[model samples]
Target: MHSNRRINVDPAKIHCYIRELDRSLLRLAKSSTSIKSLTFIDSELKRVEQCIVRAARESGNLVASRFGGILEISSKGSKTGKDLVTDVDRASQNLIANIMSETCPGHVLLGEEDPPDKKQEASDWMWIVDPIDGTTNYVNSSNIYAISIAALYKGETVAAAIWIPWPNDDGFELMHARKGHGTWIGDSKLHVHPENETGVPATGILSSFPRWMPKAFNINKQLMENQGEIRNGGSACYEQFMVAKGSMQYAITGVASTWDFAAGILLINEAGGKVMRLNSDGLFENFNGWAENYKPDPQTYERLRKWRGLILSGPPRTVDFVAANLSLKQPRLFTRIKMLFNN
Candidate 1:
């Protein structure tokens, strides 16, 4: 009778156990990339995606809990004191790192808050994280902040997840994707807007203006006058995620790093949009390759820590149009003097 008696189970505990099982399967899949086993690959991708969702949720919750409260503000860069790092940022990163470690043991962790201290090995299977993609926005009490995570296997991104801290309820907004699988927000899949059939070109674009890259201001102004409108949300992840979701025609910025745009790059690709970096010849080339087979030596890695140039993302035609219209040549001394006098 003791053995035959029915036993009650906590549904929450069962859910947690299932989540663990998914994470384990995902780790197995990530470890066996060379085999190209479709079954394992698919299953593992799903699992990595699950881990991403879980991490994003937990991190977002922590952010929400601390919102509107007094935060410990700090700085990272020396001399300039331009870049800001807050206690919330560190706490959020720590939360994500801890959660990911619990889910996938032995997987390498690389985060913006705490980057890899030692040389990055070629075989490193990495989870790249940006605990708060829009730190300034969060500090200013804006809703554009988000948590981003991506899984890199041999330098290729196989899965990514980003969570927007919004509504202050219902678990926030989420966007995610896998290499072959489509991108999605909540339960709905995302797609780039169809090309305008009426023949009139898209008038507006989304863009960024880093304080360090003021030279691009002239071109950005030109885009605003020629195009219908220009917008800067102060959040790199939000801009790219919006592009992938068809809310923006394209995104332009002076420069970006892996953590700033890695997750959203996959989203745009999987959503049938394009991402490119301008070349010296004034032609657009796929910068997506930067995320693949990336084993840079310390010097090279430091150099690539932040790249400078035109970064654009959108439908092919729109991106090409913007690239061609914007003048790539830096203003001559005379031109700069004339502009300053005119202003």
Candidate 2:
């Protein structure tokens, strides 16, 4: 039986644990007749990655098949019509969840559309998924949508895959990464633009600050005014992939959930870039810890369901620049007093 106890693992130790687990699994695979000798942990992870990509690819095809047909769209408690959920989204998520269940049994599935059970603890193995990232774009036939999936073992992102349905004039694109194994798009390795070469005047940024979030208003405004160009692709994963490919300097979002940024964070980090939190303080705290120690409880899931706040990511220099410039909007006098008294 799975434990109901909540646990938090240090992010730093996750890679070590995965390595040890890989070694043990390798030995077991060699001995077990049912397990092929090549089915080591790394290969197993890659297999899962491929499975996710396949599911996402098929989902894209489903969307393509329905294009110009009818997309049964609806809102998921968002006041704005831009925040949408569609039949394709649910279908894609269901497909991913089922594949994970069949391929990697016992793993926890935490998806944007289908979260794990509230009674369980954060499992040692957690698969984070965003079935259709750019729902708004997808619904409108913008071709900027993507399916994002990531494997989190004890809080560290072990493997991630972001499948872009229509990457360019060519065809679909798959960006994926495994811990300690560089990020890749198709067969080419991805690298962040060098600090010296990435200047703000020429750099493009993908930013989104929900109109309801007051804290990000001034900061986001400044970003729009100062950055060379600010683009909102409506899909967080795709924007992060653009950053990873050196096409964009940074992707900043004020209201991001785990599924929205999980795969993207790993992608940028593995591509020699940095993902940093942005708030009133300019301090660079570790943002990966929360996911590393996630608890699958109602309270934790409730918090994860809400917007967590702002994230700035890209080349180190670009991240630092944005962090330094962005500051929370100050509360009014009465609001400040109320907040202070409440605190």
Backbone clashes, each candidate: 1, 1
Backbone clash pairs in model 2 (N, Cα, C under 3 Å; residues 3+ apart or in different chains), count: 1
lDDT of each: 0.70, 0.69
Name the weakest run of 10 consecutive residues (lDDT summed) in model 2. Answer: 334-343
Q: How does model 2 fare in lDDT?
A: 0.69
TM-score of each: 0.75, 0.74
How far out, in Å, is residue 274 in model 1?
A: 0.5
TM-score of 2: 0.74
Note each model's CA RMSD in angstroms.
Answer: 15.4, 13.7
Residue-level lDDT tens digits of model 1 in 1-343: 3667789999999999999999999998887764678777789879888998889888888987887789987767774435677898889889888877888776666677864354543334567788888787887888887788887776667788888865644847888999888999878999975655431236543444344333543355644455534678777788887888888777775454567776887888898887887565455577663544356344434433343445678776766665666554454632442332110
- Choose the strongest candidate by lDDT: 1
